[model samples]
Target: MRHLTVFDLDGTLVDTPRAIVETFTAAFGALGIAPPDASAIRATIGLPLGQAFGALLGLPADDELVASGVRRYQIHFKEIILPRAPELMFPGVTEGLDELRGLGITLAVATSKVHASADALLRSAGLRDLFALVVGADQVAHPKPHPESGRLILRTLGVPAESAVMVGDTVHDLHMARAAGMRSIAVTYGVHGPRELAEARPTWIADTFDDVVGLLRAAPKGLAG
Candidate 1:
């Protein structure tokens, strides 16, 4: 069993992709830039907000445009995204979480979202108390695809990366887990399909949150928790 379970927020636990996409559209319009394709915006779900928008919208990653994009999104996010949120938290998510908690597993959230947003979403969705620690972008020096986010979570939980499993719905999460030397588990129901996540080399892949619990239970010793 995995001793430490790290999760991604947006696409992994909550289906807030619509809110995210709409916020990006508003941001682009505010900046006088063309909005990205809907699918491309959706595909940005699990990446770091700035990096995701920069990559999808063709904005220079290191330029002020990226910062402006984030700022613009924040302007409308409270009114648009937050109001539209607290969406589907995925089938079996709470159940699996409860099961893991019962088994004495430590849970942490390693997400690129700001801490306030992540906390609000979790509290609104009745999952605020599920995690022992919430390592949001506000708390981490680096976002996903970088090990720092996961490392911070692991540090907070007092568990080594060897004892952790990172559960998310994107290649970014997979890459993050890999960078942290933690096991990676992908779910197909999130932003990226199985095909897209396949190239990330996850240790396990599931179609649903329920399947994820099963995989975790059966995962070989020393792999997770």
Candidate 2:
């Protein structure tokens, strides 16, 4: 059966650690606020910008500081870092994606990035054409762990919950998939680690991008129930 595979952008399919760190640092610098430690910043990735800012700053989501910080962060990423940084696709991502497509699986992205920014990044990595749909933070009222984005992707893909999988590198991804009644696959090379991901109970854990391709090829039954 054909599958609808929903992938997360930053950690799962790409290593964007540089862009994330630099942007957050620059934004906080611009605002005269000391940036959170690098590890703390990295840990909160895969969340919405507002939420991430709130967590790092110890403020409410609706606080003006978080809102302003997010805006400044996007500005720095767009105007400064994006032009100079290398493309961020993880090793084997393109080959794995090609193989998964060859297996007749449909691919889409559900990420915390804004639609335009995520599209630009994917295009830079030459992976944009592989996705049937791209769902971004701006497009959804709520981000991952809320299930709205995953539900939207599955609906748009016309794939049943049981016939799809959510591949990502964070607990939010696993929780979102489970809440959507879809299978979840966590990749270790991303932001979070196995110990944390295990708490979310993914259907499977992949060590490399190729392992994801293998999982889809094997099409393990009863995984997405």
Candidate 3:
């Protein structure tokens, strides 16, 4: 009977594979470094920019190279990628969200994207006003998998962890839910597969956005009708 739902933005709600791939590719070129394969970039979508850059480049998390890469990625993403091809909501996203809202469920966003960018993306996609809270990676001391973002969202929304669920597409999202002591629903159509999400042990797995809405509709007595 989860009353509060925290969602991961990039792959779960919005389709940003193309923007991510192109941004990182352009960023790597800006740094005069060889670009990682597109798959490599896709695999790191849910992580914070610095961590994603570190993972893609095989550098230490705090390395100067990682910082430089993150900066470059942000620049290209804002200046070129976002303007050229802003990410769009995935199929059924708006409808599912609308249905959930109608059911009196509170929605929030917990994403690894920086605050301004995350805000702008949601606004551009006509979703900024839908979420009750939008916790960004930069707003927290630690991002997903550490639970800072999730915990903050729950606290701000005044929702108990046990009465909330994190809906996401990546292991990071599931792990963050577990770490925050909340239930998790993993979607398979995002950045990661069921095998990867299973490693994080989500309470449920959804194949489509409508399936996620169904899960909410079936929630306990007070949560759903």
Which ranges in model 1 have alpha carbons more than 4 Å from their true place? 220-225
lDDT of candidate 1 over 51-99, digit per residue (tens): 8778976777677889988888878877776654555678778889898
Would you give me the overall lDDT of model 1?
0.82
Write candidate 3's Cα lDDT for 1-225 as tens digits. Answer: 448989998988888866889899999999998899998998888889988998888889899999999888888877764553334678888889999999888999999999888887888788888899899999999998888999999888889988898999999999999999888899999889889888888989999999999997776453321
Whose TM-score is higher: candidate 1's or candidate 3's?
Answer: 3
Comparing 2 with 3 on lDDT, the higher-scoring candidate is 2
Ranking by TM-score: 2, 3, 1
Local distance difference test scores for all models: 0.82, 0.87, 0.87
The 10 consecutive residues of candidate 1 with the worst lDDT sum are 216-225
TM-score of each: 0.88, 0.93, 0.92
Residues 123-203 of candidate 2 have per-residue lDDT tens digits of 877789999999999899989878999999988878888998999999999999999999989999898899999999999
Model 3 misses residue 113 by how many Å? Answer: 0.9
TM-score-better candidate, 1 vs 2:
2
